[model samples]
Target: MIVTYITNANDECNTRDSRPPKQGLSACGLIGHQLFFHQVVFCAALPDNTRMQVSSKVITGFKNVLLVDYLAARFPYFSAKKWAALVTNGRLTHNGQTATLATRVRQGDTIIYHMPDPEPPADWVVPIVYEDKWLLGVNKPAGLRVHSQGKFIAENLIYYLRYQHQPPFPDVNLVNRLDIHTSGVVVLAKDKQVLRQLSADFAAGQVTKTYLAVVHGQPAPPSGVIELPLARVPGTKTARQQVVGAGEGKTAVTHYQLLETLGADYALLQLHPQTGRTHQLRVHLAAIGHPIVGDGLYQLNDEDYLHWLRNGRSPQQMPLIQRQALHCAATQFTHPVSGHPCQLEASLADDMTQLIDKLSGN
Candidate 1:
């Protein structure tokens, strides 16, 4: 389980630490997850503690790549934990086994991606808390992606399923996506028919979504509402979503109540996004003032922070919490086909919880 940043086919350097990693689709204008075609460079025998220079073709499959030990069931190579290091890190563009001492080529096949990645094993058995033949539901962890996108193309929950379990869940699909930085319960359709039904319901606004977030500052009161139209301001690519004039924006709304204020500087919020917009929770909150902690994209840039203040957010405070602190805490909707109501939610993951605890202690 080596943590190496992919520069190309040859040069890969190890990171200081593998914690608090960073990516995916066009979420908030992000590179997001896109799949790539790759090739395998065969190795004769397990090198004696020698690192192999992976071909660039395979490395391009992921963004901010990390080389991991992939415990391939299909290929016998290394121990599972060793492989989990890289696999869990969102690395491993391809899975291969060590060529037998007397063998020739390894299991290097050009695997084409279906625009989706594997799902985490934990989520699979997490309890079909509520399930039917048509749909399956489980609480998704924070830092997990619903589909393939930039740095997380195939290292996420969706990809994990195909990698680990290919039987009962031969076809896994996400009707909607939760932010990679957010955590909560998500629903998946086992087949294409169920997928279409659920997708339609979402488009018709027949679905219900709930989220929780830890913010930099406390809202003045226990609860409040935000009505802001959001839009992409051209010329400012790679930045926090800017608040714009009505004519230049799309309709977005959020209802949030302070669940608990850690102090004058921090608060826990129960959020509900009325409309599904990119960075909806993060943008709205930033427009109001508080930015999610560790918001690498938005807060990472001071100019974007300034732009947020110019939007609807009060200029009274700068970003404190970073990252898109918003999480998809819960969701409810009638089964697209079954008509039976379904609901699910995920608890705070280690990263979020640890961040909260560390900051609170500070």
Candidate 2:
């Protein structure tokens, strides 16, 4: 225990400025007085590996706080790159006593942060579609996650499915994932046999996947195949994909056949991806200057959109609805168990159908 000068109760404190604490009325000096106060305790740096476990007694008003929490609450980006240098050199106050971060925090002391920090919320849930002893397929919704996360990680599709139901089958392995922004079909395997079989099948092109997309503009011709090679963009860990030379990137071929034209700005098209490159459909569409509507990562400029909107065009003409106007509608594969050809199809989900009708007035 260390000697401390406690701050008098009824004082509102803010760490807006990192200044020294001024002397204040003492709790010990007043006899027979049971007023609440801020206690300051600083411990010397003892060990490198031992983490400073922080648990505090309830002090009602001032509350419990750590040095990191204190500073992070003030300067959000409290790091060398953002504002760490200034904050690192700052001090805190105990009662009227200003103290450095090295000052130990006792029962009722407050730690001040110059910058406030809030953790960005990362959340998602994915829904499973098909699973057998060997194979599992998921109708991954847009914004659903496949794996664990910080607070919201366990709530993702895979976690939700596994947690909600304790199925007889063991750990279900996801062989693939659709982009969190792309709502579509995903496949999983429960066991190594099924995984190997499905992996082999997918590699051998035994799986035929078909998708429906609403593009930004009406495709010019009757219909055509977009066989552009694709390349994953650098720097971005994910979500940025483009077309590039064969040796430079993977050969991503998409055959886009026009399903119907809503107007001058939007067209409903069926997409057949011959190659399983990442973001194949979106990249192919964007490469043709007909990026999907609401593709935030790409298509920021509305010049093409504005030109058409100025001409009394909305997705009504092109029928580019909200979100990613793309959906995995069907998949075809031969059943490993029966050795018979099987096809699975999902009707347009409510969101897709609703958006389609809402925009096209269908």
Top-TM-score candidate index: 1
Candidate 2 per-residue C-alpha lDDT over 266-311 given as tens digits, one digit per residue, 9 for 90 to 100: 7778988887887788888999888876664556433554554366
Q: How accurate is candidate 2 locally (lDDT)?
A: 0.55
Give candidate 1's TM-score. Answer: 0.59
Off by over 4 Å in 2: 1-129, 149-152, 166-170, 235-238, 301-322
Per-residue lDDT of candidate 1, residues 1-362 (tens digit)? 22123233355443333344332222111123222212222212121233332222332233323233212332223344644544444344443433221222223332221111222243443334446787767666555566655434334666544444434353457788777656667787887788988888887778888887888888776788888888765666454467787766788888998887775688888888778888878888888888676565555466655565356443333334334566676788887665777787666656677666766775
**TM-score for each candidate, following the candidate numbering:** 0.59, 0.58
CA lDDT scores, all candidates in order: 0.56, 0.55
Highest lDDT scorer? 1
